[model samples]
Target: EAYAKALRGRTSDHPVALPHPDVTSQDPLSKGLGLMERMAEGFALAMDDDFNSREAIAKVLGGVREATRLLD
Candidate 1:
């Protein structure tokens, strides 16, 4: 939600502005980031479904740690 809003509001003038690629563009980085976003969204939804489940929380945290490692 926040990310989608930020992307929508971005302008070419911004220092780190992304290229306004066509909708059909097969950009690998974009696709990878999109997949990550989906993974995060799924984690959020799962947490909502079972917030008190220790197993679910641990899995999501492990995923987040892995993602942080990849980013680093």
Candidate 2:
């Protein structure tokens, strides 16, 4: 939400704009951190004592690793 707002514009009404810390970064680590954060959210939301949930979390982790490697 904040990211989208930053991408659009910032003002009293918008309250976010370009050149924001999250929007201005061109660094792999920064981007990777964002991805990791999202993955963590998904993991938390999907948590359960079930095989499918565990498998899904594993897949998300794998994707994060692959993305990090590509960003590298």
Candidate 3:
């Protein structure tokens, strides 16, 4: 959510801002980052289903780590 928010809030060409690209020309890394976003959505759903926010939080961290490793 924060990632998407940053993308929305940042001005164009800002360093450390997420790139806003058209569907056709985006880099593969952006596609992978999209998966991280989907995982966050899943984590939210899991939290609602299981009612254990701790697990949801862990899942979010794991997803972030995975995304970081991918970027690195």
lDDT, candidate 3, residue 18?
A: 57
Which rank order by lDDT, best down to worst? 3, 2, 1
How would you encode candidate 3's per-residue C-alpha lDDT over 1-72 as one tens digit per residue? Answer: 547676676776674655543223346446565766767777888788868787788888877776676567
TM-score of each: 0.42, 0.43, 0.48
Which lDDT values do the candidates have, in the order given? Answer: 0.57, 0.58, 0.66
Q: Answer with 1 or 3, whichever has the higher TM-score.
A: 3
Output the TM-score of candidate 1.
Answer: 0.42
How badly does each model clash, as a count of residue pairs? Answer: 0, 2, 0
Q: Candidate 2's residue-wise lDDT over 1-72, tens digit each?
A: 446645567567655423322312565445555666666666766675354587667859865785767456
lDDT of 1: 0.57
TM-score computed on alpha carbons, candidate 2? 0.43
lDDT winner? 3
- Comparing 1 and 3 by lDDT, which wins? 3
Q: How much is 55 displaced in model 1, in angstroms?
A: 8.3
